[model samples]
Target: MEAAVSCLAEHGWAGSTVAVVAERAGVSRGAAQHHFPTREDLFTAAVEYVAEERSTALRDLFHAGPAARPAVVEALVDLYTGTLFRAALQLWVAASNEEQLRPRVTELEARVGRETHRIAVELLGADESEPGVRETVQGLLDMARGLGLANVLTDDTARRARVVAQWSRIIDTTLA
Candidate 1:
């Protein structure tokens, strides 16, 4: 699955075949097919696998103790700037053109989005009961995704950090 994610992240949906992923994982194509009968099965499972891992990682980071709001905000943004996001973006692009992949991708994205929102709310100490508070947190996620899209072409590190820092302040003021 890790190999599949890496393949998708680096080469995208068109280039990331089960055969290539098997080669990357040092396994035979037949063995790869044994686990994932089809390409859709492999790629969907791959993105879902890494998304779960990333969520667990985020929770583990904050499990030791409470982090500052800025740190939490930065971590939230970091979710969109890595391998999982890139791999998932490829799936989204494929899903756009492929009718067979569309429904699965839509469901997967909704599940991932809800889970991420829940994690962000918990980690950021966000209060959803308050009006506009939920949107504030969602805004953070939407902005982070936009930054991720911007990062698809070139390194947006310096600018992304600035945006995250500003977002930290915005959330502190708005969500407070």
Candidate 2:
């Protein structure tokens, strides 16, 4: 799994193969096949593992307290740009090319979106039916995704930091 993560990060979904993963792991192709019968299975496991890691990080940061919300949001923005979003982008590109991976990718996306929505609700203490809360959260998510893509295309730390700051202000003002 660690080898898979490193290979996926290095070569991306299209370039990464079970053979490559096994080679990176210093395991035989037969062993890799024994563990993951199909590429879809491996991709599914990778997505699930990454999602779990991302959810844990966000949960830990957000659950710290109201005093830590800004830091949490900033860290989330950084994460979105650095890892989760990049992996998702690779998955998205792979999903476009491979029909077998589509359902797994979609499932992972929905799980992450649901988790993010839940966290936003908890942070804002906002009702799901509230007028502005959902919209604000959605906007924040959209911005994060966009900023993440931008970060990937250009190593723009200052711009990403600005976006994080703006997102924090929006969340704070809405909650206030």
Candidate 3:
């Protein structure tokens, strides 16, 4: 899946053939086929893998309180900086190029959004009626995604840290 991610990142959907993924994985085409018979299957698996990893990371981030929380939050922000976000962006681009991927990509994105919103609500201790709370959380997610894109394209560490700080402020304000 990592090989497929790298292939997708480098060549996009059209250029990332099973053979190319196999080559990148340093496995035989037959081996790759044994695991993922089709491009759609490979893409689906990759998306699932990334989502699972994010979920695990988020759970770990929230495992501790206060002292470790800030660092965990920063690590969470760093996770989105390039690696996982770039993989997801590649999938989004792939969906544009391949109709077969559109539905799954959209579904995964919605799931992530919903899950993140739930997390934000819990972290903020805010109820549904709270004004601006939902919007702030969603805005933070959007900003995080945008910063991820910028980080990938420009490798700008300062801007990435600024994004994290802005998000941290939202959390702080909401919890206060």
TM-score of each: 0.98, 0.86, 0.81
When summed lDDT is taken over every stretch of 10 residues in candidate 1, the lowest stretch is 167-176
Give the alpha carbon lDDT tens digit for every residue of 133-173 in model 2: 78877777777778888877779788777768877887877
Report how far off residue 91 is in candidate 1 (Å): 0.6
For model 2, how big is the CA root-mean-square deviation? Answer: 2.1
Please give the CA lDDT of all the candidate structures.
Answer: 0.93, 0.74, 0.71
Model 1, 54: alpha-carbon shift in Å?
Answer: 0.6
Could you tell which candidate, 1 or 3, scores higher by TM-score?
1
Off by over 4 Å in 1: none
Cα lDDT of model 1 by residue, 22-121, tens digit: 9999999999999999999999999998899999999999998878999999998899998889999999999999999999999999999999999999
For all candidates, what are the clash counts?
Answer: 0, 0, 0
RMSD of each: 0.8, 2.1, 2.6
Instruction: Pick the winner on lDDT between candidates 1 and 3.
Output: 1
lDDT of 3 by residue, 1-176 (tens): 87777677766677878889888888999988998898888866876687677777666766676333344446556656755577778888778777788998888878876876676556445566778767766776676677777777677898677767766876666645
After superposition, the stretches of candidate 3 with alpha carbons farther than 4 Å from their true spots are: 66-73, 123-129
